[model samples]
Target: MGKLYVVGIGPGGFEHMTFKAKKAIEESDVIVGYTKYIDFIEPLIKDKEVLSTGMKSEVERAEKALELAKDKVVSIISTGDAGIYGMAGLILELKKDEEVEVIPGITASSSAASILGSPLMHDNCNISLSDLMTPYDLIKKRVELATQGDFIISLYNPRSHGRPHYLKECIDIIKKYRKGDTPIGVVKNALRDGQEVTLTTLENFDDTIVDMFSIVIIGNSGSYIKDGMFITPRGYKL
Candidate 1:
């Protein structure tokens, strides 16, 4: 029985991809992922059998990958770290008894934080504003608690055509506990083409641009903007 390697091709960039991820892809006989994600690693999978599906077909992809792995080395790729809002969990959940190797990669929060300086220096939490899988009310509740606890928050899938007002609603929830002057970092297409990084405050977050490809970092009470960088200090004695 062949093994399945769930790989993460971080931030949609070959440079951002880890060596182990690359090796896993190279060693695999079949590669599977969402269409856009597969395109990100086109060069590496030229000679392999590629299986790609459109968005919202994760279940199909996971099932196909497992089936293929029964006799051939198969790799299923996700844009960010496989375990963090990626295919690893779903794949593992579906095949509990199978031996699956999950290779980690740089996640969106880390990618966006790096672009904006050090906004994730302190304790942080990642929340997806998209309610496709999780309910909006539950997401809002989690956001409220994370804000009340002063956790640096990184939001994924912050906005989309169908859910235009969700991010704004989340901003309102954060404002209840955070000051208007709290630092905020918005990074679009982090470490990839057409990358845009903006540093602002909670008061002016509305002026920033965000989309499905963006990751928004909302700083905690101790976070600040210094030297044109968004930073959340680790409370070091300096």
Candidate 2:
């Protein structure tokens, strides 16, 4: 029996990658993933046979990874935790008779949160605004409900050239419950090259600076900024 490893390589940088994820990728006979994500791990994957696929080719990538795993150790790598909008689910769905293992890595939200301070110290929810596979209405409802619950939101895929206005729309819904001064942290390329982190208020957020590579963290009512760090109090009596 061959092993199929689904590994989350973390946010763009090798330093963010977990030991287990690195081991799995190193041990695998073949690696498969999106071209951009593969480019992030080029240093680690040197001398290893890799199969790269372009955008919207996830199905093909998953199928190929499973097929390759039938006889040898194959790895499907993703940025951030593989289960979170990664290739793990699709590969598993297409997998049959293969021993599969999912190695979790430091997700972008958590990583970006670390850079911005402790904004996720309390209850929080993650939402992706891609709407490629998920519907836009559903994404809006999630944004509305997350805001109503006062949950610190870690927004993934919040903006893209194709759906530029969706993030602004989501922000408008959040304003219905949160104050205009609510702290918002925007991180781009997270720990990767040219990374940038900014602490701003929802009212003054610059949508023009965000892209598909950015991760946005919107703090809840209890959230505040101190010494340029965004903090969401865990409600511990001081």
TM-scores of all models? 0.98, 0.98
List, residue by residue over 12-103, the lDDT tens digit for candidate 1. Answer: 88889999999999999999999999889999999999999999999999998998888889999998899999999999889955568999
| Candidate 1 clashes between residue pairs 3 or more apart in a chain or in different chains | none
Local error of candidate 2 at residue 89 (angstroms)? 1.1
> CA lDDT of each candidate?
0.92, 0.91
State the TM-score for model 2.
0.98
Model 1 / residue 89 / CA error / Å: 0.6
What range of 10 consecutive residues in model 2 has the weakest lDDT sum?
A: 87-96
